[model samples]
Target: MAVEELVGPAPKGWKYKTLGEACKDGGGDIQTGPFGSQLHASDYVPVGVPSIMPQNIGDNRIIEDGIARITPEDARRLSRYLVRRGDIVYSRRGNVERRALVGHHEDGWLCGTGCIRVRLGENGADPRYASYYLGHPVVREWIVRHAHGATMPNLNTSILAACPFLEPPLAEQRAIAHILGTLDDKIELNRKQNETLEAMARALFKAWFVDFEPVRAKMEGRWRRGENLPGLPAHLYDLFPDRLVESELGEIPEGWEVISVDTEFDITMGQSPPGSTYNDIGEGLPFYQGRADFEFRFPKRRVFCTAPTRLAKIGDTLVSVRAPVGDINMALEDCAIGRGVAAVRHKTGSRSYTYHFMSSISDVFARFDAEGTVFGSIGKKDFHSISHIKPPRDLVLTYEKLAANLDDEVEKNEQESRTLAALRDNLLPKLISGELRVKDAEAFLKERGL
Candidate 1:
C-alpha cells in the first residue's frame, strides 16, 4: 500500500525518510543480540543483572519476574549488548512487531540472546517519538513486509534499517510523543494500581477463608467469643464460628462444609457453535476458544459467533479445560465460548468470591487432566467432582462485599486503558504524518487533562 493511503500525507515542510537514513541523521545505532554462544545459558546467575529476552517484553515494558539473570561479571563481559535508558528493544524472532523502550528502570540491563536493541541518536528523532512510530499500525505493516524468515518471521538490522519512516520536524516529533506518552503513563499507572488492588483482595480471601483466621484467633485466645477481631466489625466477625470441625477434606472452620463444585455453584461446559457461524466483525457476542484469549483477568476480543451454543454471564469465572488448562479469566460481559473453556457462576450471587476461589483451585484441574500431545482436556464429570471447603454462606457474602469494590475498580481500570489505547491508535498515524499539527494535538492533550 502507498504510504499516503495508509498513514495520510505529511504537511509541506515534512520530509520522507528511511529508517536507516533517519537513524544515521540522528546519531542512532541498531543491533541484534549476541548469539547464544556469546551469552551462554551457563553464564546466568541466580541473583544479579538481568538479561532481557523476548519473554520479558510485555505490556510495552519489561516483565522482570521469571526473566533470566547473569552475574555482574558476565554482564560486563557482554557490555556491548547492554541496553540503556531510552533505547528500544525488539524481539528478533517469532514476533518482529513486539518491542519495548528501555526506561530508567531498565537502564544498563543486558539485552538477552534473542532480542534487538536500538539506541536513537540525540539529533534525529525523539526516542519516545520513534518508539511510538514503531508501534503505529502503518509503520508496523511496513515492518511486517520487510521482515525476513517467512517460517517464523524474523528481524535483522539490515531489514529493519531499510523500513520506511516519516520525519516530521524535531519539535513536532516531541509534541506527538508527549501527547501519546501521557496516555501511556496513565495506562501503566492503572495497571500497577490494579495489581496492588488484586493482591489485597487475594490476601483478604486467604486470611478469611483458606487460613480461617477468625477460628485460629479464638483457638489461640487472641479473640474472645463476643469481641470483634482487630480488623473486622463485631457483626462481621460474629459470622465466623470460633472453632474448627473435621471434614472429609481437612479441618475447616466450624459451620463450613466440604462440597463438590456443582453443588455450590453453576457450571456451563462450553459447546462450540457451528463453524459457519463464527465471525470476526462482532457478529453477535464476543467469543473465546480458551485461555489463550485471556488478557490478565479478562479476555481479549478475538472472535464472535452468530450462533452461540453456550454462553457466560458477566462476572462469571471462565476456566480453560483443554491443554495448558486451569488458566482463568472473569467474564467482563456476557460472551460466547467454545468447548475448550467452561463458564462458572456462583449460586449465591457472589461472583467475585467464585472468581477468586476458582482461581485458587484451577491448579488442581491442570495437573490431573493433562493429556494428548496438543489437546489435553478434562471431562464434565471430573470437573463437577472437584471438591473444596466452602466458607459459611454469611462469611462468603461478607467477603464479597469487602472484595466487590476492588474487583469493580480493576474492571474500570481495564476499560479505561482500552479507551486510552483506542485514542492512541486513532491519533498515531495522524500525528506522525503531520495531518494533525503539533498545536492541535497539544490542545487535545490539554483538554484531556494530560
Candidate 2:
C-alpha cells in the first residue's frame, strides 16, 4: 500500500506533503547556512560556539570530533544559521544524502558552511520521524537525483523544499520513531563502548612497544623482580631487558632487532580484478578497495567480486597504501582486496600484535602520503622494506595474550552493534511507511529487551 494511504475503516489522518509545506504548517522554514563571504576560515577560534560543518554530520547524529568553532560574536552575527533542537542538517555538497538531526546538545550551534537546515514547527510532523523518513532509501535517492552539480551534487533550499514527506498523526509519528530509536540507542551505545575498548588497547600497545616503558622502568629501578608496576605485571618481569639500544629508527629496547616489515610479517599487496566482475549484490566474496571501505576496526561490507584476485584472510590487518596512507582496519572475514590496500599478518599468527603494531606506526606510513607530489602511494617494495623494531617472540606473545582479551570484547560489541543496526534498518521503512503497525513493532522490540 502507498505510505500515505489510510488503513482500516477509518482514515489514519496521514497526508502526503512537500517538506516545505509541512515545515510551513509547523511554523518552521528551510534555509541554507552562512555563505563563505559571511564566515571566513580565519574567523574560526580555538574554543567557542561549535559550527556544524558537513564533516560533523553522521548517520542521524552530529559528530563533534574535529568540529569547527566560531567566536560567540561570530555566532551572534550569523544567528539565522544557528540550528535549534529538532532541526535537520544536510550537507550542501558531495554526499548530500547523508544528514544529521540536531538534538538538545547541538541547539544554538551554527549550521556552518556547506550545509542546509530544515526546521519543522512543533505542530507539524515529528522532527524525529521526519529525519527517518528522509533517510528512507527512496527519499535519499530522490535527493541525490535532484541535487545540482555534475561532479559533486549539491543540495539547496529549493531542492530540499520539494522533498516528499509523509505526515501521520503526531502521536503515531512519535510511536514509530520510538520503536526504531530504541534499536538505534543500543547500536550507538555499542559504538561508544567499542571506542573506549579500542582506545585502551591502543594505549597499551603504544606504551609497551613504542615507548619501551617496561625496560625504562627496570632501568630506573622502579620495577623490581617479582613485583608489578602499573601495567607491568610481576609474572612478566623476565620478559623485558633493562636497557635501551640505539637503532636506525631511534632508541629501542635491548635484545630487540631492527628488521624490515617483510621479515616478521607476510605482506600481500592487493590486486584488483576487472571492474566488470565487481557487484554490490554480494554474488561472491566481499571486496574492499581502500579507506572508503574501512570503519572503526573492520571493513564494512559494500562491494563484492565474482572473480577474486588478492585476498585478505580473516583477522589480517588491512592498510591503505594509496592516495592517503596509514588508515587501518582488520578484515572480519576472508575478503577480496583491491590495489589500494595491503594485507599484513604476523608470521607467528598473532592477530592482536599485528593489528596494534600497524596502528602504532601510522606516522611512518603517513610520511609516504605526504612526500608524494600528487596522490600518495606505497608500492610493494617500499611497503615491505619499511623498518620496524621486533621484540622477542615471547614478549610479543605475552602482550598479545593481554591485548587480545580486550580486543575480543571490542569484537563482540562491534558484532552486536552491526546486528542492532541491521534490525533498525529493517524496521525503519516498515514503521515509517505504516507497513508494520507501530504497536506491533514496539512489542517486538520489547520482547528482545531493546
Candidate 3:
C-alpha cells in the first residue's frame, strides 16, 4: 500500500522514508528478538532480569505484571536482545499493531521470543516523537493491513523496517512529543489515583463487613465510648453491635442477618440483539458484550446497537456471567448489554455499595467457573443464590455516605482524563503532519492552562 494514500504527502521540509532507511541514516538497526530455540521455557526464573513478551506490551508502555524473568546469566547470554531506553518493541505475532517504547526502568531487559526491537540511530528521529507517530490510527491501520499470517497476524524485522516513517525537524518533533506526553502524564496520574481510591474502598469493605473488625474490637474491649482508634472513631462506635452471635455465616454482629444477593439488589441478565443491528458507528445505545468491554471502572463504548434487546441503566454494576465469570465494571451511561453480562444495582439505589460488594465476592463467582461444563456460566438462579450478611440499613447508608464521596472524586478525575485524551488525539495527527504548527498548539494549551 502507498504511504501517501493513507497519510497524504509529507509537509514541506518533512521527509518520508522506510523505517530501515531512517535507522541506517543515523547508525541504528532493526532486529528480531531471541529465537525460541535460543531461549527455552525452562530458562525462566522467579526473580531476575525481566524478559518482555507479547503480553507485556501495552499502549506505548510495558506492563510489568505477570512478566516472565530470566536469570542474570541467561540475560547475559542473550545480551544482543537487550532493549535500551528509546528503543521500540513490537509483538512478533498477534496484535501486530501494538508496540511499546522502552524506558529507563527497562534498560537491559531482554526482548524475549516472539518480539522485535527497533533502535533508532542516535542522530536520527526523536524516539518519543516516532513512538507517537507510529501510534497514529493511520499508521496502525497500515501495519495491520500489511501483517502476514492467516490465523494470527505476524510481524518481523523486515516488515517493520519497511514501514513508512515520517520525519520532521528534531526540535519540532520534541515539541509535538512534549504536548502529547503532558496529556498522557495527567491521564496516568488519574489512573493511579483511581487505583488507590479503589483499593481504599475495598479495604474499608473488608474491614467493616467481611472481617467484622469493629464488632470484634468491641467484643475484645479494644474499642471504648468517647475514645478513638485507627479507622474507627469514638462517635461511630455505637453504630456497630457490641456482641457477636452464631449465624449461618458463622460469628457475626448480633443484629445482622444473612440475605441472598437478589434480595439486596435488582438483577438484569442481558439478551443479545440480532447481529444485523450492531454497528461500530454510533446508532443507538453503546453495547457491551462482557469483560472484553471493561476498563478500570467503566465499560468502553465500542459496539452500538440500533435495536438493543436488554438495557442497563447508568450507574448499574455490570458483572460478567459467562466463561471466566465475575469481572466487573459499571455502566457510565444507559447502554445495551449482551448475553454474557448481567446488570446489578442495589435496591436502595446505592451504587457505591453495590460495586464494592460485588467486588468483594470473587470467591463466590469462582465456584461457578470451576464447577460448570467445559465453558463456565452462571444463570440467574445460581447468581441470586449467593448469600451475603445484611448489616442494618442505617449502617449501610452510613458506609454509602462516606464511600460515595470518594467514588465521586474518582468519576471527576476520569471525566477530566477523557476530555484531555480526546484533545490530545485530535491534536496528534495535525501536529505530526505539520497541519497544526507547534507554536499554535503551544498557544492553545497555554490558553487552557494545560
Candidate 4:
C-alpha cells in the first residue's frame, strides 16, 4: 500500500509534485497560443510554416496531412508564439484531451491559434516524459474536469500548470520516456507506412483504370499494344486496347464496362437504432453515422447500439451517405449502422478492389449528391444507382495480387498500434505512481524490442 511496499521505496527518488512546482524557476514554462484575432483565418497560405492546430494533434502525435500554413513573414510577425522542439502543444479549445509533442521536424512551427504550448526546461523534466505524463488517464481526467467552457471545452496554461505529476529521478524519467517513446515511434511508423502503401495502391488504380495510362502508352507506342510492359507480364497489356472508346463515363479501356453500383455492390443503407438503445457502454454493437466516427481507414467505436436495423461485417466499406458524403472507412468489426451511413461488400470477394473502387468514384458520388439533393447528400436510391467503372476482371485480379498484401499489412499494423497503445496507456500511471518500477517497465518494453 505504501510507496516502499509498492515498488521498493519508490526506487529511491520519486516525488509527488505539481507541474507548476516542477516547471517554475526552470525553462519548463507554458502559455496559450496567439489571441484569435491576432491570427486571422485570412492569413493562412498554401505553403510556409507548419502551423499546429487542434486538429493537427492526433493520437498523441502531430499529424501533417491537413495542417494549415502561414507565411514566413506572418510567422515572424507572431514570432513570440513560435513553438520550438521539445515543447508540448495542447488544444486550447475543443477536444482538450488531445495534445502533441513538438519534435525536431516541427521545431519553429507556429504554435498557431486555438492551442497552448508547454516548453520544457533544459534541466528539468524530459519533454517526452512530461507530455506522456500529461496524457496519462489520471492527469487527463483532471484536465477534462478543470477544463472551462460549457459548449466548447477550453484548456489554458493555468489549468495545465495546476495539474499534478508523479516525478522520478531524471535518469528514471528518461528511461520511462524511452519505453513509451519506442512504442509511440513504432505506431507513428506504421501510420506513415500505411499512408505510403495506400498512396501506392491508389496510383496503380489511377494509372490502369482512371487515367488509362496503359492505353495511352500503347497509343503512343511507349508500350506494345497487345504485348507486355517491363513489370507487366503475359497479355495483360492487351486489356488496354490501343485506342480510347466513347462511353457515357467518357474514355475508358476498350473492354471495361461502365456499370451502375446496384450491379456492383451488395449495398445496404443503414437504419438508425432507437435513441433509447444507443449508449456509450459498449452495449451491443459498435455504431457509426458520419465521418466524425471515423479513424484513419477504419471507424472509431464510440457509441453502441442494442437494437440494430442494418449492419456491416469486418472489412465492409462504410461510407458516409449524408451531407459531406463519400468519406470512406472500413469496418474493423461487425457494427450496427445508422441512417447516415451505408455499407457495401464486393460481390467478387475482392476487399481491396471494393474499397478502391468506391474511392476512385468518390468525386462522381459527390457530384451526384450535388445534382439530385436539396443538401449535399446521397439518398439510398441515388447511392444504389451511382455509376462506376468496372475494370477488366483479370486486371482487377492483377492489381489485387500486387496490393492485397499491403492491405493485410495495414490491418496488422492497426491491430498492433491498438495493442501497443493499450500497453502504453496501461503502464503510464503505474510507472509514474511507483506501482511499477522503471526496471519492470524496461523489461516489458525490451521483450517487444521497443
| Candidate with more favorable, higher lDDT: 2 or 4 | 2
Residue runs of model 3 more than 4 Å from their true location after superposition: 1-6, 37-48, 245-250, 371-373
Question: Once superposed on the true structure, which residue ranges of model 2 sit more than 4 Å away at CA?
Answer: 1-11, 45-47
Q: For this target, which candidate reaches the highest TM-score against the unseen true structure?
A: 2
What is the Å distance of residue 112 in model 1 from its true position?
Answer: 1.8
Worst lDDT window (10 residues) for model 1? 1-10
Q: How far does residue 144 in candidate 3 sit from its true spot (Å)?
A: 0.1
List the candidate 1 regions with Cα displacement exceeding 4 Å: 1-9, 40-46, 245-248, 366-376, 448-450
Clashing pairs in 2: 26-121
Question: What is the lDDT for 364 in model 1?
Answer: 84
Q: Summarize candidate 3's per-residue lDDT along 289-310 as a digit string, tens digits.
A: 9988987787888999999989
Which residue window of length 10 is worst by lDDT in model 4? 1-10
**Residue 386 CA displacement from its true place in model 2, Å:** 1.7
TM-score of candidate 4 relative to the true fold: 0.91
Q: lDDT per residue, candidate 2, 247-362, as tens digits?
A: 89899998899999999999999999999999998798999999989876778999999999899999899999997898899899999999999999999888989999998888
List, residue by residue over 77-125, the lDDT tens digit for candidate 4: 9998898888888998888987898899999999988889888677778
Off by over 4 Å in 4: 1-12, 225-227, 279-283, 365-376, 448-450
- For every candidate structure, what is the RMSD over all alpha carbons to the true structure, in angstroms? 2.7, 2.6, 2.4, 3.5
Cα lDDT, model 3, residue 173: 88
- Score candidate 1 by TM-score against the native: 0.91
In order of appearance, the predictions have TM-scores of 0.91, 0.94, 0.92, 0.91
